[model samples]
Target: MRILLTGSAGFVGSHLVERFLGEGHEVVGVDNYLSGQRRNTELFLRHPRFRFVEADVSAGLPVEGTFDAVLHFASPASPPHYQQHPVETLLVGAQGTQHALELARRDGATFMLASTSEVYGDPLVHPQPEDYWGHVNPAGLRSCYDEAKRYAEALTMAYHRHHGVDTRIIRIFNTYGPRMRADDGRVVTNFVNQALRGEPLTVYGEGLQTRSFQYVDDLVEGIIRLLGVSYHGPVNLGNPDEYTILDFAEIIRDLIDPRLGIVYEPMPADDPRQRRPDITLARELLGWEPRVPLREGLERTVASFREVGEGRPERVGVDA
Candidate 1:
């Protein structure tokens, strides 16, 4: 299949490109590099079945071709990137999504959206389910990302229902692995980088805030399965294993350097107090569940970070 994938230079998007190319699919990747790295696209520049286009999907997709699948993964995902480019975040979720959907409609192709767990926004529900209406703040510090994904999901459904476009929406949980930007301000990269440098790991607030981390490979697998399945509604794709910020910090410290200390700092506003995806829907529908353990995934991630020597102590965003 020939696939049109936006945000192909992103951490997760790059992984998807590898998988898709390996499976003998022709992929046309698009990215604006707002948060994605150009190095990622370089990994596939020589691939026979891959092509990369440098353009922002928010304005338009410049590629001209009828694709079998259109996966919309563009947008600044991390707090720093989205907060820094708040308007771009909103535009991508609004205009970028519309552009992708329109292209998919034009080609009569399958459409898949990469939505985030931020939509839950300090979820009141203990373990969030697909049926739960999220507790998101429409106007808040994190609203740029949270509301954008929420609106994107709504738009995806609207396109699916009204236009009969084949659509899939996967609510991605806290995914981390190699290719993650060290300066992205996410907790995983921050802790890993700081630990590698033998610096005190920064833990926001009491470090009681919980999050479910999903390895990128596992997430890519779930995405592949969802694409093959017939489900049209949103499905949670993440690991069920939960960990507090403090405990996660300890794990990273142990992996990198056991002597690294943990330091508490002020929590960011609208940070989710808890997040654990109820993947029961994913399990029953797609027969998918995260396979990589946290420690193992962290080991691989640390190896990648160490190889590149990427580390810096900065304000960490706990929202995954």
Candidate 2:
């Protein structure tokens, strides 16, 4: 299969790109750098099955041919990056989706948008289902990524409904793994990086907010499965093992470096109090569920970071 993957240099995308290449698929990677790191995709540069393009996804993307799959994973998904460049973030969410949808329409290929669980902004629901119409605050600090993804889903469905383009959306939950930007400021990376550096882990809002951290490998598998499945619209792809911010911090401290301690700080405005995906739909439709446990995943992530190390924190839009 010839797969066109945006955000290929990102933490998750690079892992996905590797998986696709390993499966013997022809892969074309596109990244604008933004929050994505070149080192993440560095290993794929020489692979005969892989090709790369350094272009902003929102800038009227160019394409060569029909692809078997179109995985739209571009856009600054974390807080720092999206907030730093809000307009560019929104444009990628809008234009990137349009460009991918258009390409899918023209090529008759399957289109899948890597939507975020952040769509369920500070969700009121316990275990958010696909049918839930999220409680996002359009004017909040988190709005850039949340609303952007919300609208991206809208555009994707619009293309599917009106233009007959094959489309699918996966609401990815908090995922973390190797090659994650140490300074990305996500809870996982922030905690891990701080631990690796033997510093206090920053705990926002009394460290009470919760999230189900899925490993990147599980997420990549779910993405591949969702792409091949016949589902339309969105599906929740994340681990259901919710953990409190403090508990997560403790785990990382214990695993990576015991010297790391926690420090309380104000939770950012509009931060979700809790997030746990109801993967029932994913199981039924894609026959998939996360296999890696949080402990194991964290171990793998810590080991990876130890080897490569986070040089300095690069501000990235915090993601789900």
Candidate 3:
């Protein structure tokens, strides 16, 4: 099948392109490289089954021809990227998503939205399930990303219900792995880079806040599986294994250098105190659950960072 995938140069998007191509599908990739890396697309530039276009999906998708599937993965996913380009982030989630859905509607294609766990802002629920209404601050600093995704999910459902479009929404949790930008300001990258540089790993507000980390491979697999199923509601795709910020920092320190120091700072406003996905729905519907352990995933991530010498940085910041 031929597929049209936006954000093809992004960390997760690039991985999806590789997976789709490996499964013998033709993919037309699109990205404006806002937060995505050109090196990622370069990996598949020469592939016979892959084609790329440089365009921002928020404005419009400058592409022709029909596709079997339309994967709308475009957006500034990281905190720094979204915070830096707030308007663009919001536009991508609103206008960009509509454009992708329109294309899917036009060609009678299966549409899949790449939503995030941020929609469950500072969630009151311990383990976020598909039914939770979420506890988000609509006017907060992080609202740009959180609300954007919430709006995207709503639009996805509208397209599905009103137009009879086949749609899938995957609420991606904190994912980390190869191709993650070193300066993206995510916890895993921040800690990994800090440890590699022999610098003090920065932990915010006593480092008691917790987050569930999911490996990219596990996420990509769940995404592919979702496409094959008929479930159109939002599905949680993440690791249920939880860890506090301090404990996670120690794991990174142990992996890179046991002697690395850990420093505490004020936590960001509106940051979620806890994040753990209840994947019972995912298990029952898609027969999917994360398989990679945090340590092993971090080990592989560290190896990837080392290969590219990507640990040197001024200071560490996290999306959470």
Candidate 4:
């Protein structure tokens, strides 16, 4: 299949591009490099089956192609990155999503949206399932990303229902692995970088805010399965394992240097108190569940950071 993938230079997008190419698919990658790293695409620059286009999806796709699939992974996924460019985040979610849907409609192709777990927003329901109506602040500091994704999901469903576009929505949970920007400000990269540098790990608030971390490979596999099936879903794709920020910090510290100390800071506004996906639907529908343990995933992520060298830390944001 020939796939048109937005944000293909991002951490997850880059990995997805490699996965598709490895599976003998032709992939056209589009990115503006807003928060995505160009170096992530360096390896694939010469791949015969891969083509890269530098463009922002918010304005338009600006490419002509009839693709078998349209994967809309564009957006500032991390809190810091999105918050830094709130308008761009909103535009990408709204306009960019609309453009992708139209492209899929034009080509009569399958459409996959990379939605985030942030839509759950300090969720009142534990182990959030696909049916849970999230408790989100439409005008909070994090709303730039939260509401944008909510709107994107609504738009995706509208396109599916009104226009009969084949659509798939996978609410991605916290994912980490190779190609993540060192200063991306997500918890995994932040902790791993600090631990590697022998610096005190920064923990927000009481450091008890929890999150579910999934390996990128697991997420990519879940996405591929969803695309192959006829399920018009908003499936949760993430590990069911849960960990508090403080516990996660210690785990990374121990992994890098058992003696590293931690410093607690106030938690950011609207930070989710807990996050654990109920992946029963994914298992039942797609026969998918995360396979990488947190310890092992962190080790792999840390190894990548080591190879790349610790990038300068940017302002911390809400934990993914």
Give the number of the best model, judged by lDDT. Answer: 3
| Of candidates 4 and 1, the better by TM-score | 1
RMSD of 4: 3.2
Question: What's the CA error at residue 171 for candidate 3, in Å?
Answer: 0.6
N/CA/C clash count, model 3: 0
Stronger candidate by lDDT (2 vs 3): 3
lDDT of each: 0.89, 0.84, 0.90, 0.87
Predicted candidate 1 versus true structure: per-residue lDDT over 1-320, tens digit per residue: 99999999888999999999999999999998888887789889999999999998999999977999999999899877898899999999999999999999999999999998878887889689988899877988889999999999999999999999999999998899988988867788888878887789999899987778999999999999999988998999988898888888988999888987898889877564468899999999988899998889999998888876657422222232
Instruction: Please give the distance, in angstroms, between residue 98's alpha carbon in candidate 1 and its true position after superposition.
Output: 0.7
Model 2, 1-320: lDDT tens per residue? Answer: 99999999888899999899888999999988887887766778889999898888798667687798899998777777788889888888998889888888888999999999989987788899999999988998778889999999999999989999889998998888888877666788878878877788888887766777899999988888877768896999999987888988999999866776688888777564477899999999889999998888988988888777453443333232
By lDDT, highest first, what's the ranking? 3, 1, 4, 2
Model 4 quality (TM-score): 0.92
Residue 49 shift from truth in candidate 1, angstroms:
0.8
Clashes of each: 0, 11, 0, 3
Instruction: Count backbone overlaps in model 2.
Output: 11
Task: Report the error of model 4 at residue 77, Å.
Answer: 1.0
TM-score of each model, paired residue for residue: 0.93, 0.92, 0.93, 0.92
